[model samples]
Target chain A: MTENDILEAAKQAVVAADEEKAIEVARQAVALGLDPLRVINEGFTPGMRQVGDLFERGTMFLPEVIIASEAMVAAVAILEENLPAEQKEKQAGIAVLGTIEGDVHDIGKGIVATLMRVYGFKVHDLGRDVPLQRFVDEAKSSGAQLVGSSALMTTTMVGQKQLEKLLKEAGIREQVKTMVGGAVVTQYWADKIGADAYAENAQEAVAKALELVEG
Target chain B: MTSYPTRMGDGHAVEMSTDELRCDILAGTEDAADRGRIPALSQEEQDYLLDLFSYPGKIVGVQPGNEVVLTDDGSVNALYGAQSSSGVGVPLSRELAIRVYERAFCMDTMEVGHPDYSFKPVKPIVSLEQQCLESVLSSTIIPIYYGAMPNLALYAKPDGPFGNPADLLPQGKISEARAAQEEAAQALTRDMVYVGRKMAEVGADGFNFDTTASAGDAEFMATLQAVEELAKTTELSIEVGMAAEFVLGMHGQVTYDGVRLAGLYPHEQLKLVEKAGAHLFGPVVNTNTRRSSAWNVSRAVTFVKACSEAASIPIHANVGIGVGGVPMCETPPTSMVTRASVAMVEIARVDGL
Candidate 1:
């Protein structure tokens, strides 16, 4: 099969959330001596980009996005393993993401992590109900420039403000950027909490994370 | 050729033919599904849903003689509701809330969240509710129910007495989640019964478990257990208001009445709510923010209609803010809200909102 045909199959595999198809396409691309990075950027990445659009337009739901992301990640991992050390794409930035303390919602945060990883960010996912201090510690240890927190409930969202305060207390507030998001989180709340950005969903989180890292 | 009232994806008012609505409803329900992961509504179910919306009205409503009771959670805060930049509602005094419920909103049934808002633990809010009940039972004719969430997350780490599964399960500490969940559930049940009996003694008409099971299946099981235990003594009306259309099985293994509680939708949820001895059931259907009110109403009615059909007790569908086909935005537009309300009552035949 042609290289272009294999790459197109890779893209469709991600869109269909067909992990086996993604793996098969990755293997075929490797057999054709195609650039692994090209397969990711030109193929699976665009598929994820379309998935994000479908999700934003209400044509897709969270579970589908999650599945698609998993498929893409699995495909990317296969592609990355075969890449020469010097041929790897440069990392975008380092970021830490988590659902804040007292909120056990990880699905949105998980999507954000997956998208961020595809966008080339070295992400440390702290998972759900993460302690506020952990964000500061991870930022310090990893020297992550971007930190994102999600809180799905109003009661637990108070932890976001505490996270901002903890970052400042650790004297890393000025050095790192912070983004807050969740079902109930708003730009207003982000501003009130002194967060650098507010994202309404995972797609927006990736955009904001990129903007924050670049700007 | 009858045209029905509905809203566009952007919340604009619109009219559509029965065929258009049927397509929209089917498509909308499809969108609401997990993209072939969960069960899609069968064609027979789709036909039943279309029939519910088949009535011709600019906006349908219950017949002139058949009005339903309007019960609400977080109702006291409706009038005195303070929106902060942080989106937290400001807590108000018991007396001020009573005035707002009676003099302002003139609500038939008065319900109050904790002074810190309803999504808090009842243990700390019990005295506050007691203080409010002392004033409410004497001052107004409105029947009052105490409302709070079974927020199991709060029962963990620096709050209550359990390990945070959020920390445990993620770290591959899978064996500990079951025990942590059990302890948290027990604590939540104790607090609910304690506060319930306290309100019952103070002349409260009932207890409302608003937003039950938001934390997951463990939280839901606890609420069911609390309802059963409370039913033994107090004749107070218990309302089980759900947090979502389907139960997320965070604990995954939790069960009630010998049936697993995880993955139960509104109809299945109501059956357990009845078995648990709740006098009222509030089924929640989340809205797709990017979809039209018609789409949301159709998808919501698909679930609520089933719940209403199976319900023996009162079914008060939560149609406010983000659930029950209403828009997800704060201050959901009155036009769509009204249209959704009308469709719910006329189509789903819910007993109340």
Candidate 2:
């Protein structure tokens, strides 16, 4: 009905992880005199912020994350549809995300990617068991603002440090901000490996990304 | 007719080695003559068979499970941990691996109670339990000296990753719960060292550790440290079981409606466990067995992600023909036993046992 109602509806849809509803409400909000930027900035992003918190707390698991991310994508999908041709072509900063080699766990990475998408970050997702060079190469080619890797095991967590080394060896250390996380990854270890930042959870990753961007 | 259905130790004790007894049992089974067997065996059978077989050493790799499955490689896999009857498996053909495990684990551990069980208890549980125990004690067990006494080797998950799970998240709550639960379970087990010491005092030798479904990786290692201490003053050896929790998220605490949790969060706790020096691991997630709630195959496979996370230790996992809770399903005994056996072997292959 009103612009306020439409935005509220869109926010609820994202939190509920209802894609079709998110798209419908997003479109309706735009039609009801809501700013496209406002709907995204105020409505969709906050829902995902909560999703990140839930995931970190383990209150939400994989299926729930998938649902919430779906809604975020749906709203984004609708928003992109209404943008001017030139604006559509405009890209957000790039991010390369992956789980380190020998680690097949990807739940935390998946949440980070979805939240990044909600924030209008262009993400190149490299699924589980990613080799070190693949991360380095993606960062070089994409010129990503952040190169992120997750390793749940302490043994494999060494891959994160390796990625950072590869970045330096490739002479691109300053070009890409390397971020790493997993159960065993502490801020101290981040300093040890020269990772620019570390997110304790998916939400922290987003905040870290923002800080890294601004800094 | 000593009410064959209710006989106890119907056959004479074997003076030969358990391996020889096994051969004799096989011979008797093949004889098609008068057959006698052990009576109804509870899990207590492990101990009964240990004495019956008259072996001096602990058991190792002889297949242990109640359910069996044939892997593509022809090795036997079995359902290990908490079962009505235990199993002892050996390498048979691809086809035989399944058949043998099913017969050993899936079949009734009792003697000829059922009229159709005209087959004697002679080939029943006592022989199987003794064989399983001896195989493990004889080999899978090592005498590691922390002080002056020997602490037996515990569960190892070479496929697991490192770190306590909740550490993977930003939330202190998740890690807190995981940490607390592991602390409690392991503390309980570590204290069992005293009980084990008492058992060894009376010639019990060693007791198995049921470390399944534990919560924290740190707590597990602490428990082991405590047990290692107790062993210095006692004569007991220890065998530990791996839990679904360390590999999967706290078991009943989390599930993926249908998707794989293992695939979703590949880096959790299993690897850190190995760092603590656990050399053996066991897996046979009973989470989805018949009595288990809402859990499914997708949830079970999530543990697979932890499989490659650790290295240089053997791990064991299993499947049941009946699905969910692999514990209750009534399938052929051999398949159940083999399922458990093969899981351990696979862990050995993949984890560098």
Candidate 3:
């Protein structure tokens, strides 16, 4: 198959949520001496980005996004395996994410984490009700480029600001970027809390995370 | 059936107590068996339930779904689920059901349905509806969970009584979860049948079937089946309550080759509900914080307008704002309420709702 045909097939595989087909296409592209990064960036990533777009536009539900993420992850894993160590290591940015303390709503956080992984972020998801100290400590330990916190309730959103304060107290505030989001989180609230960025939804979170890491 | 008490024969204007009136109303409607089992409602309670149904506009009640189950020492822990060791799990007594209905009504809520925090047992729905219809206003609505989350205490059990969270699995070992969810959905339908029958027996208005907490298309469709089943069995109007975002998700958001899209927007959701033979619609907007500013108000207005436009039946916006223990904004509560109300009115007028 031509290079463009292979890339389109890979993208379609992910969109169709055919994990095995995605992996098979990625393997074929690698065997064809196609650039592995191109296979990921031009093929898998675009497909995942479309999935993210569908989700953001309310055209996709969590289950579809999740299945697509799985397909993307499967294909990306194959492509990353074909990359040289140095290039592969440098390709994806590291990040940490979680639902703040006193909140158990993990659906949104789970979506963000999955999308971040799809977009080639080395994500450390701390799950729900993560304490403020854990966020800072995990970011410091993992050397995350971005720390994202989600809070579905206004009461628990306090933990996001607390996490920022803790990062400062640890003298690492300047070392990392902080982003906040959830159902009740507005850009105004983000500004009020002095967060580096605010994402209204998972797609926006991915975009902001990219801007923070790349910029 | 008992007859209504006539006005005083002497022509002297008599101030009859509410209890006397209620007693007379109960005499004709309630049989000896029912009277012995359920106590007569006080005048104040009757008025509380009636006033909500008679409100000028749509009736809305918001529950944050945050009611927690406390340990014996009173520390709040897990969510109040079906098996929680609290007042929630116990079958509600006849008197308690009346009080529950009364409290919901007093909150300007037309429907007496909430999450695990408060629910009437399926058995008492008929008696409760009967009492309300006889002494109070019609149009009382009882809300039922169509696809409820599995009782956490029953998590991982093969025969669990509700939809297990694990049922959303992608592949193998999901059969048990699917079976469990189907069983739960069937159970819910059976309960709906019981409730619908009772409501019909008493000449009560109707009930609402809510699927807000459903996890995905499977759970949602299963719940819809239950709703359809209830419709087939009853002539009383049934209102369907769905999560706004879930509806949005189902309309066109997610696509999987083999997966059917269950997402719908407000209008589409209302259409589906209408096709199911329901005559009322409740679009629940459950936010985690208070509407402290115009931003929040604008969001509410946008959501309300969408729901109002899509609904052919009366739309009840079940809005849950502000967590229980959260501190309020600097703005006073009264001011916040006024601002929110004004925003809603302006939006309604602009949209011609």
Q: Each model's number of backbone clashes?
A: 0, 73, 15
Chain A TM-scores in order = 0.75, 0.82, 0.88
The sequence of per-residue lDDT tens digits that candidate 2 reaches over residues A1-215 is 87667667777787777888888888787677666767876788777777666555444543455567777777877777777777766545689999899776664576577667656688888877899999988888988988989886656788888888889999989988888886546565688888899876567888888778667
Which numbered prediction scores highest in TM-score against the true structure?
A: 1
Task: Write model 3 residue lDDT over B1-353, tens digit each, in one string.
Answer: 43222222111122334444444333412321131222333345334322322233432232244121110110011122222212233355433443454454332223333233211253444464456444434332332211122122122233344534332332222444445545554554455566666656655455555534334444445445545766787666665655443443321222223344355444445556666666666554333232222223333444555556556666654432321111123222443343334333433221211
**Order of candidate numbers by lDDT, starting with the best:** 1, 3, 2
What are the clashing pairs of model 1?
Answer: none
- Per residue, candidate 1 scores C-alpha lDDT tens digits across A9-71 of 988998887989999999888878899989998999888888887665434544455567778
Docking class of 1: incorrect
- Residue ranges of candidate 3 with Cα displaced over 4 Å: B1-214, B222-237, B245-261, B284-312, B317-353
State in Å the error of residue B314, model 3: 3.2
- Candidate 2: C-alpha RMSD to true structure equals 24.0
The residue-by-residue lDDT of candidate 2 on B1-353, one tens digit each, is 11111000111111344444334333322221111111212223223232323434322234344232221111122222111122233333223333443455443111101111111111234343334333333332222111011111111111122322322232223444344444444544444454445434444334433333233233344445544555466654433344333232332233222222221221233343344344443343333221111112222323432454343444434343222113232232342233223333432232311
Question: DockQ of candidates 1 onward, in order?
Answer: 0.11, 0.01, 0.10
How much does candidate 1 score in TM-score?
A: 0.69
